[model samples]
Target: QQQVKQSPQSLIVQKGGISIINCAYENTAFDYFPWYQQFPGKGPALLIAIRPDVSEKKEGRFTISFNKSAKQFSLHIMDSQPGDSATYFCAASKRTDYKLSFGAGTTVTVRA
Candidate 1:
């Protein structure tokens, strides 16, 4: 079984709109949750991350909402611009584990 699940394989948003992506995981051992964004040519880069201690986190236009009991998380982009369009992935890792399990990626497009 896949440890993590993601929804809406693809999304399209207008300029200055909000874009959202969701993720769910089955592993209770997971202690770290991170989101990654990737452009066409470059490698995926860490966008934002959250520990179960906090329910939510926000940085600039990016936000990560996490639910520990529910084993779920979500990413939201505010005022999404064309440059924000990219593939986003949600991942989970345990404190002692070196490997990270990633949910299927979501491809977002911001229309100019």
Candidate 2:
């Protein structure tokens, strides 16, 4: 298992709303989990992440829920705003490898 897959390649959320997306993975060897947020053309920026050791991790408007046994994870956006609109990606890798295997990518739209 060496791949992570995400769905709803695009999403739409209203301001003050919540956006939820899901992802699945095949590799159980991954040791680190990271999420990236990207703008129109900029490189993905590290958002929030969670390791298998933890069930959930939250930071500001973002949260990551991890299900180690299922090899699944998810991202939740609270108080979604227009400014939150962007592309989100989920990735995983081992501590030895910095190269992140990312999902297909999800585009979120938060209307004002």
List per-prediction Cα lDDT, in the order shown: 0.94, 0.91
Model 2 scores a C-alpha lDDT of: 0.91
N/CA/C clash count, model 2: 0
* Residue-level lDDT tens digits of model 2 in 71-112: 999999999989899999999998789688999999999989
Best by TM-score: 1
Candidate 2, residue 91: Cα displacement in angstroms equals 0.3
lDDT of 1 at 99: 94
Q: Estimate each model's TM-score.
A: 0.97, 0.95
Ten-residue stretch with the least lDDT total in model 2: 1-10
Off by over 4 Å in 2: none
Q: What pairs collide in candidate 1?
A: none
